[model samples]
Target: MSRPVMGACDACKRRKVKCDNANPCANCSISQISCEHRIAPRKRGRPPKGSLRQLSQEETCESIENATADMIDDSPVNSLFEQDAASDPQATSVLEALATPFSPGTLTTPPSVSTVLRETLGKGSLAAFAAVSRNQFVPNVAHIFQKLAAAVNHQLADEGETIATCAHKCVDIFMQYLFPNTPIAHEPTLRSAAALFDLVGDFLSPEDDETPSIERLRALTLITALCALVNSAMSQGLFSTSKSLTWLFYNASRATLRLYEEYDLEFPHSTSYHIRMWQSAALQNSTGRDRASWHIHGESILLAVRARLYDEDTISRLPQLEAQLLRVNFWLMYLADKTAAAFEARPSMIPNDYLAEKLTLREQGGQDSLQLDLSRPCNGHSLERRLLTGFHLKRRLWAAAADMICELRLFPTRNQVFLANTEVDRPDISGLVERYLNFVGHVDHLPEWLQSPQRALEGVEAHVAEYQAASFWAQRSNIMSVYHCMKLVILQKCIEMAVPEVVGLNQDPIFWAMQKLETSRDFIREVQMVPFVCFKVQGEPAVSVQPFSLTSSVAYSC
Candidate 1:
């Protein structure tokens, strides 16, 4: 008969010695390594036992034989347990769990100086500064910088887009958080990079020797974010007007350009920046014509953009143009509004009789102007009631330009693409054209207290084609998907009205409310995640909470 088998510790199994069945045998326990044990769940029922006295030798032998037979039957269970332990919860360790797996197409390595860098540059790396030797940690800083620099160089040498993107992101984050505010005791890059390494130190410990995919995605996202920010500043003039803010904008721009150069990426179009700089400069002082120059530049940009939209190779130009045009309309409206206000505040500031007559008309009836439906794209009426001052006309033209942009965006396709091809069929923009007519029909009826009639009328007229177009933009998903972009645009436009003295003092109620609209727009962005893109000048946020039901999506067409 076979003797009954029993479990043993790893050390006992290796030595072929009988184990006392401690969690770990004495040898392994003393070595201070992991202690593993195989334990089966307790059975439900009691085992059979002798009822009275001790058994005789012959009975004991028979019992032993039965026990040996039972052990043989359970041997397969032990083998199963061994298989499960290889990856089982009981077998897997905390250290192993902490190590995140490296992404594919990357190399992970054991923690070295890079580990120190991650800790140092990471978010909260200075916790144990008193315990660890400062000198030891300091040396690791240089080593980390060397590694990062080498990594960047290697990425540059390689043609992989992913690697290049990742390298740029690492560099950008380092620049944003580290170099900007931190006081540097050494060369900027060294301290900055070291600071960065400190943040990610936890991951470096017992490093799994694999390259991370998270880093790649992180880099791509950061680059995209930076681009979006720069675009916002350019389109909205957020950082352009103030001297302090301009530095922020300029640094962001420089950082982006450096990233682009690092990967041999082509520069973005040159026109957008020039226009933004021009708008910024105009804001330095109160000059309407100078502000209008921004509008002219915008028109030039729009025309240039038309020429470049067709070649499949020129896809980048589309967004650049769209953003610039959006900005142009915003600033043009800004200048017109300001010009009208100037005429109101100092009637003597009227440059000519044309402006003077319009200002008179605006002063008499413009303060009570009602908003036409901006949700459905349409143009407003012509300014028949105007007189001398250019203020009303300027304000109207600005509003009209804004409406035109909305129509331009909603047009089935760009006119420039059609111009590029001699044989290309020109589809009618009649839909938007019709909406513009509806907008005009209502212009004569809308109150002038809130806006200049001419401006209101022109804006309504620009939406004519939107009424006839398909309702693609009216969907919940589509509206929300681009809501962030819309909010961004609105905030940018409102910011354009930053003339310190003139805009506030304008007697025209519409111009007066423009200040309120500035604050209102910002507040609306903060609260209303679901934006209706209203064209009506003064609706409360509560009015916008309902589902947007305009047939034409060009409601804010201007």
Candidate 2:
């Protein structure tokens, strides 16, 4: 037979796919391989050169291995491999060699180890040893602690690292130091010795997971420090300094919260102190105005505690946790108001991006400038961010309160009802349904607006009146329900206060008008009436007959 065209396997020419060729192609040998069938090569102004050809599998393997080895052996290539493998688990030996104590550029290097440990511990090491104090390793322990403390102290002195950063490192060392059975002094001893609590409080980053016990312990210590600070500051008889102490208290609380967040923790019992104060302030005030403000502040701390105590599933067990967390919920309901108060107290602290717009005509140099450089400084930006945080935090608190009340409305817990109306509701909330019906069904959002005796509702009387009128209609009976509840609550509260007739049932003209209106029909179950329980004018029952804005009436008439 004539020689048949033969060619190498297609895989030989392409870098992909393994070739099954021997000398040329095994099949080609069986069928007689031919070079004529090979793919054409490039031509240099001449006819095409020889076509593709195949080689033995051994030769091909050798060639490929040589090419790979060459690439891998290059200086740059080898260095990359070394760098990558150094971090790999398989490279333990290599990493071990590199993991020595921190040098000048290393993260683990202690800045002040020699200063603190060598000097401080040397003073006490002999005492620790003579008594067989766990100080057997006192020298070593002190060395490590001193070095770390020195490094940390040095880092803190730089002002480059924040209190937060120092707190993190300090906690890490403390945890490691305590994890072993080594005999260190009590936590308080360490705290006092290091002045750590004063420096960092209890910084708990949500991201860490070293020791739950340590985190909780540190949190308690920080709380103790805070109480001490508050107590001491109060005793100083310096309001300004006391205010700063409160700020410190807030910072300490914030730091504790961070730790609680990290270790899935809660200080429910410790938090009860604030809760009681809040409830006392809230329930004690018949006007429910100042109580509401206090309640808001109380709620914020309560929320922080609650977040540590329970997770998402806590709601499923809301009833059981409610009484305990009600104090928290109570305070949460008023956080927005508290936040707003804080904001108002430091208006200058509130960052305003549009502040430059307030510049007077003369304040703007070379008037008629198209655009002024309104950009703020670094500090200004920081203030802006802080203000934004406060604004957002308040907004979140308001939203949370609304949602909580909505949830409370559905659950109908006794504590919630008592919170709604202190007068009719039992001190213990046993009359939940009755108090709830009297307060929630009738009060609506009026309780929230009861800031300064319904100042907010009064200013927007036209709006209030519109809603109040609609509430009287059968189709929109829900509104009327809430209004009735509120009226009853206000009356009960007034009676409890033992105000004379001029200030109680007989004192409020609106109450008398409503009484008259209710008596119009002997058997009337429903009546269309005004929702204002606290009237604007006194000794003028006719004033209730006229539609008056709560604000204008309260200020002008009263």
Candidate 3:
């Protein structure tokens, strides 16, 4: 057969079908198409803009790999990466080295789509995918994200049931460990959502029916799955905890927040808002070495204040039942901020002047109507109510301890020295110490049910005893830590005044100082046994104390 010419006619090219060797080609003639043989001269600077040839798969891959390499070398990503990576002996990340044009033993072949996908997903470059996916019906990467979970599971899974199973497992993991500390996303609601999700999964898979709800529900399920996956992996190995957990949770949380921005949709605030709080808590606890959730805490504070969290009058306008719930919620947020500040030696976001509704133990004289009365405590309301009351009481004692600790550092400045002998500061410190001690005595005298771990939940609706126990242990551990820390700070600050002469032993003062030191040591030992439980102060009396967010409305009947 005669050889075909290098280029085809315009008509044949546009049609994208083979042409006959004749002047009018068989394709054009059969379809009654017009064909022209005229050729236009191309300019040197830029080729004619009519129509560019589509690249072959090999060429496309090569182009992408080359362009990516160039961008890495010339773009800001490369600059930032180098700035951070330059500290290493090789001065390059594994990724950077792999991408280099002439790296020894590195693959120089054109990258495959699978390769691209893995690289995109594995590196911090998931963000670019996230940004693309943030716009609805966007071109390019949007569909990639939409189908990301399915595509991933598709490879690892044989059928739809596996995804449903994963979804359930993740929900359990979340509810068990993290959810108890902060039920940001309400558990019961998530339970219902999961049910709906299972239904959605059944409809779309095997049945082959698809719907918009499927998409949204899928995103939500993916979030929990990612969260649980991270936690599960982190629990398994501490060495890679920070790196892996951080990556997984970031994508999960990004997908979560992106749902709101891209779809203009979010789970109802009743649950979603709290879930966000849980995310923040996890991030704070994500890394072993890094325990501070400061940035997240700070963001939460600003948002809370904007929502008038500090305004009791605004909160009181809600239904009497909800008003009580809201009050405890805000109180917990306050304590969280304060605890963070105290630990970091930073100023608190909760301004000292702000008026938080006082939580009071009920007595025969109901003098304080505004304060929550322990007599008609929140225990009887719901399971969460029980937690609210317990946490509120505990946090009050913590705040009291905090006040005593603060008294010791009256003025923190270069020239400021705490003078124990000063008449004015002396009584302030003495009185605070007395108050904290009395408060501990009061806690000791309180009813057993209030202080004991609510494992049986005999009257409560919640069941996970382990989760409750963990939450209780967390609060109890922190309380003891605060107590010891306060005692240590107090005695250490005043040891100069407590015992002036070390040689004579000054009988009473020396003995008292030694006793306080011993108490501090004992508290330290207790904490070591429950290291994870008490690391971060679950200052939120509402959820931290009662992870489920609802407990019985405990009454403090006089």
Candidate 4:
């Protein structure tokens, strides 16, 4: 008789071992990880897993695995349990983290190096640290970078369109549609091949092996992600298929870990670092990897705080453009991180106290990177000014939402508090409600182009006026997405907190969720209608995924 094929966790697949298919399968359980079943095992007698094909046609079966090609990772899942892997010691630190695939927002912070070291040494003494080195354990990406860089370089060559040309087109699509609030790679340096790599810095690892520059990797990742967005959009489907773009993203994300080491160094120089992180995280989040996105954004936060981007004194000292970029950057990270937490139904990484001084400072100094304000009687303020104003309005609105997430985080865990348990301590969402209410009221104050029933894709021409007009609509569309997304998140939390014993049964939170469900349906519908010749994506900027129907999704789940 043919032996039965079994569904194995990635770990066992790498080890070429068997898995029992338990939630925390025997191997993962032995490894002490939350087992995540990704690919289904081949039917008992059916052929083993076959090569994945380009998903040109929609299949009846709906799953990430079928919708997209299998992503390639650097190491086998079984590498962690290898005797040599244990000997290397560094892998032990990140083993638990990398092994865990779920991202529901309840994840603990990546264990500190010290914490990992302690675990690594066990009963051994501190000398063990002296003996352990990253060179021995760190995954070598020298050849990988060489291959990636060559692929990118080849693409950048002037075949059909130079990598620069094609990348710019993708960048514009990313800017106009994917993230209107956050401009993607507008640096003039990107235009020049010579200056581009210069800005990316030397990416050689300690082992003297070449690696893709942080900026280079980030740019390529964004371009691929943008292409993915455009391929999904109304540009009449400019790109043929999303297969290549999606494949590129899968490969690029593998290099993300090395960038974290740069948090100890290179990340702060380019404003694009965190932006890229947010964008990549969004792309990953859409792929059902909210936890991965959250982790990536957390790295951005670490870099931002270490660079003192949050300190008003440091920000005030920055150059005009850098200062403005930092202002917007901090808030975008804040909003992105907050959304990730709320989506997975977990406590926020950002604390409320961080905003106490920062919010007022942004409202006063930052003009959302537009560097202009025409809020007064139309002193002939340009459309760009209006767009910037909308950006500012979004910053202000999301700032409130950030506060809302932080305040809501104070609630007891979902399992800790029951609907009928009034005796337990729960968080106060009153502030969240008021802030969100205030945010909702201000949402209408934005220009007409930014509000509903407005055309976002009209006026397709090369002229300045035509571009601005279209740009206005796109920016407004992005702002609306962010606003509605925030509303959905806040209301979802309120609904979750509504206990028969605490807020009482049939309460306003539940009522608001019902009401917001309509908003979500409408917003998601409108979002789908926005036409892009290249790519389209949802959530990401705020929460980093297509959170268009977060409220409605939550409502249904309940």
Candidate 5:
């Protein structure tokens, strides 16, 4: 048989199958096609001694100059590898030495002791420490790069739409469903950030440079967190497969946030604070009352306090738009803090004393101490203004409810300690009853427009009525659920506090139990009024069911 040829035939190479290296290979012969070897075979084995001649001094110098020119070129691919190589001196030096040319007669220098040690020990050295100093000093730097790589890989592997498209959709979903209720982020700012993010081809692209700026990092953090939240919300009903994507975005947001914190530790800007606040909201929605959610909520509160977001005087000194955004942001935080504290049965991170002082100052100023100012008024009874007004009213209600929860928390301790004491020695049952009555009265006194969705849209423009109606219905449902839940908690606590000996003497446990049943019925009615789509799309049932469960447990215990 003839000796086999050096390389595969064209047909076998094109099909990527093994070749017999015959003139007409078995594959092509079987298929009745002509076989060609037009492509050159790769050179194999080392060249014989003296087969290659070293370049002259001038030739070596010219080659070295050409290599240096290529290295210094501002090309994108070159710069990317350069940036990565720059992180390690050993790698950079090796690359440089490989690129340099030498004359034939030039004497080669012996390797240094440090170089020998490095080669022997294989990367265990103080130099490695110095090389990774950037990662060591900056929090989450390594993790951020890892996430960037993963995001890039995911983008590359995705056969469908791009991240930019998904990001735009997430933003739209967030603005439509969540913005009116939460509105922690400024609308224009969020849109602008999304627009800018769309322009980024790759997060670690050479065009973006070696290091990202604080502003870029902040925008990335916000976008990722927003996507995570929207994905989490959508995963509830629209897309069953989105849970993994939701967590992917969530973890990316966390990594970006840690990197941003490392760079901007001293002054936590509104954007960073907004990222944290929204992250906490996402955590609450995705994970429920987890410790991570609680910790993130606390971090946001700390950022707000540090930024003096709670101080009206400080807020008033800013531009009108900024002041308005900050005002809404702070109030949103306030509402969330109270809700988390009440539902989680934990002490609120926000200082009640500061809130009390603010109320006192407002009373002294002759304003309605119970009502929080919703900042600058819009020109007309616009939908945004109405929604803001309603949200502030809801915030007031939650504040009251949280106060009751705190008082109820103290009751168990007091009841246990003063078991044999009179009712006077225990937490004043009358005070608790009074607060419950007041909370109920507050809900009853809400404006007709806020209480009813149809009333909210009575005079709205034709173009905006749909949005206004949706906002009103969502807000009303939220307020009513909170109201009914708070009522159940207070009444249940009242029943618990009513000692068997005092039940007949002071208040009737049967009456409180009956009231709880009534409130539960009202809650059910309100829940039924909401569209079934709302329960599925917004995960409303998951949120509302927890309170019902709590009420059930309390009733069984009683």
Candidate 6:
């Protein structure tokens, strides 16, 4: 057989099939493939048991020194490690301990540093270098690390309560104080979800393979963010606790939200918009108005758009509960966008044409298709529904204000152009005046509840508890603040634009100032009527900056 084949053909061995003792096996011959009988020799038996042995102390020292010396000679920056070793004799011991080699038979551990000193130096260097380098560079970032540590400790402290208990408390606090203002979450749904999250501890762990469903994660994110907001609210006054707890919850919420978004990006959900809105609100509460919060708000709007929230048909097709929430979120974002546009001078992300289209569609769709579903009879007895009604009324005012802002932006007044220093022809002031008048007319048309805080509270059900009544008052205060602030801003702008001869008597400086002063007085009076506890629970006033602006106007007029 061509000098009998020593073993199976390579093809037959590789295939792990039977092979005839021939140069070309029958299987390879039939397949017309190469059948070389080449194979590497295998080890005959197990390795000798006593081949490995521990090195003597002297031998170990010599080996370590030789290795260290070799590393030093081979490294371009050998001088650095030598200098480090010389400056701190202790480094030599640490290196020896860290670099100690283990016998093959012993339970081996990885070296603290890499095998090659060159690679270690290329990286951050050994622990020895860290000591000297830290003193030089640590001061620059020490405060940041200190703050992070404090936040971590605060989070860990937690008053000896578990996360579930804290989450439940946060939910209660949020529902009582913040929900009426935002009302983004459904009470029953949020409570049920919180209860579920309380039971599912494993889902909260990062290392767990059992991933939480999108809805569960969304609830968790919202709850975490709410916790941050509640802590921030609680820590408001001079006597209140430090903001470390707030920072802790805020960071946790952000981390949870990042994970939630990664999942959401693949399988989008409508409630993702709601969670994002809560996060944006929490960011604003904890960090104040910043690009981060604004960007979060923008993302919320994008989520809304993706959900077709602006499309009446799509909204109508959704379940009643989902449609209600989508509507609420849309209006809340619109109010925020308009508020930012008016105060912060940021452009509204929702295009005017889209808003106009939505309005037209709603009007054409009639009462059944109203954006807020105001035509649908709401139970007057339900505090949640009542709060939502108040929000709807507030939404109307904000929509009008937004329209006014858009109009003002389009046609710049003399003062606006002068301030901007743009070389443009003087635009007519009539459009501005008309827009201002239109906004005023819209405010006047608002129901009695919005026009007066007392009337607003009158709508509260008689059977409601004292705390529930307080929530209603708080909600009323928030909406009324927006109302008064919008009027103040418009009147202030008018005052700036007014010319004694060209402007009418109503648009005159004296008339505008009197109106502004009266509005400020009413705002202050309304704020005073709100209980001190309300302020404590609500954290910073909803229109905190507006009050100062009003105060300044009053002082200037005086």
User: What Cα-based lDDT does every candidate model obtain?
Assistant: 0.30, 0.30, 0.42, 0.45, 0.55, 0.52
Backbone clashes (count) for model 3: 35
lDDT (10s digit) by residue, model 4, range 68-178 = 111223233223233323653433433333332211111223333444445545645446344332322322334333444444444334345433344456545544444
Cα lDDT tens digits for candidate 2, 275-345: 23322222212112333334434444455434432232332334432333332233333333233332232
lDDT of 1 by residue, 188-307 (tens): 222232333334434233212122222221232233223222222232231121222222222222222222221121222322333233233222121212333334333433433344
Assess every candidate by TM-score: 0.19, 0.21, 0.52, 0.53, 0.64, 0.60
| Number of the predicted model whose TM-score against the real structure is largest | 5
For model 3, residues 1-558, the per-residue Cα lDDT tens digits are 344544456554333234454666665676585666543422334446696796533334344444443332343323433453455332243334233322111333445546665766665656544432122211112222333334324422433343345445555545433333332334444554455436634433321111123234344633553443334334333222223323333344434443343122211222233434444544433331122334534554565665664565565555544444344445656666564444444567776656445323121121212222233232233435444445556566656655654544442331133353344342223454565565455356433433466634455545445445555555455455545544555455445444312112344765766767687678757666563633432322222222111111000000
Clash pairs, candidate 5, are none
Indicate the worst ten consecutive residues by lDDT in candidate 4: 57-66
lDDT, residue 114, model 2: 42
RMSD in Å for all candidates: 29.7, 31.8, 16.3, 18.5, 20.4, 16.3
Write down the worst ten-residue block by lDDT for model 2: 549-558
lDDT tens digits, residues 334-444, model 6?
666655555445666766667775632231222222222222233233555566666666566666666665555454445577667767656666776666666666546
TM-score of 4: 0.53
Q: What's the lDDT for residue 323 in model 3? A: 48
lDDT of 5 by residue, 1-558 (tens): 655776677555444345777877787777788787764554444557667785433233333333333332333323433564566453354336422111111123333434444543463544532322222222233334344434433542444655666677777666555554565566656665667546654544421122455566777788878877776666645343344445556656765665546444456666766677556555555554445655675676777777777777776666655566656667766666665556565556776677766521110111211111224122135555565666667767777776776677677887776776665475556766666566776777666666676665676665556555565666676667767877667666656665322122247656666666777899899889865544343432325556533321110000
Total clashing pairs for each candidate: 74, 21, 35, 16, 0, 0
The best candidate by lDDT is 5
Ranking by lDDT: 5, 6, 4, 3, 2, 1
Error of 6 at 493 (Å): 1.1
User: 153, model 2: CA deviation in Å?
Assistant: 18
